[model samples]
Target: MNIILKNIKHISVNEGITINKLEQIIGASKGVLSRAIAKNTDIQTKWLVNIVKNYPQYSCEWLIKNEGEMIKPTGEIFLTKENIEETAINYKDLAESRKETIDSMKKEIMYLEEKIENLKKQNELL
Candidate 1:
């Protein structure tokens, strides 16, 4: 079930950043964040993730639970383009490996099924 976000005012005030900068950091805009907070709008998980990731100092619980201090000054979340590209390449390689494994497993399953069917037919003849 989706829960409406609370304590947005507290978060904004504690962060000490203008709405625009906050939006930029989270890859959103002033209007979207403002509407969400002011109207008690449903916050998507993706948006929430972006916020928590970009501002690591901000308490994740505070962002989701609204039950604690807003900003905790945690680690940096910035990623360079090169880092992203490398990560993407790594993921592609992993996906290819997974696909190959799945294909092999499927073939093995088909072979086993065929053997089972043949054994059942032979037993019935006996």
Candidate 2:
């Protein structure tokens, strides 16, 4: 079996979750993980990203390189200086994206409110 898949299986067992449940938690399609694990094939990087995002207690370095402890002590990620800088940039980008989404939603809400007000005025005239 591929080392990464092996580690993932170990994680599933450690967390007391079945493969199907892990797929659901990671938002992966049914059979995505199970099939790959069964076949010992590679999975996409996005699935690895989702796993890290969903299970923050696990060490990504360990998952990728198998160099560190599988689970992080104190539930905090052990990060190098470069990793810390990269994470800061990622957070900045994420914040900007969320702000744009919020602005767009606000505009949509305002437009809908105006439409409702217009409908109410038209009803009053009828």
What are the clashing pairs of model 1? 57-72, 57-73, 57-74
lDDT string, candidate 2, 13-123, tens digits: 776567776787678999999999999899999999988876667888888878799998863865667556655654564566567768999999999999999999999
Instruction: In model 2, state the lDDT of residue 55.
Output: 67
Candidate 2: count the clashes: 0
**Model 1 superposed RMSD (Cα):** 16.1
TM-score of each: 0.45, 0.59
* lDDT assessment of candidate 2: 0.81
Where's the lowest-lDDT run of ten residues in candidate 1?
1-10
lDDT of 1 by residue, 1-126 (tens): 223255545544555554554555567855777677667668667877776655455677666666566665445435567546644654564566567768999999999999999999999999
Among all windows of ten consecutive residues in candidate 2, which has the lowest summed lDDT?
86-95
Candidate 2 lDDT score at position 122: 100
Cα error, residue 35 of model 1, in Å, equals: 1.2
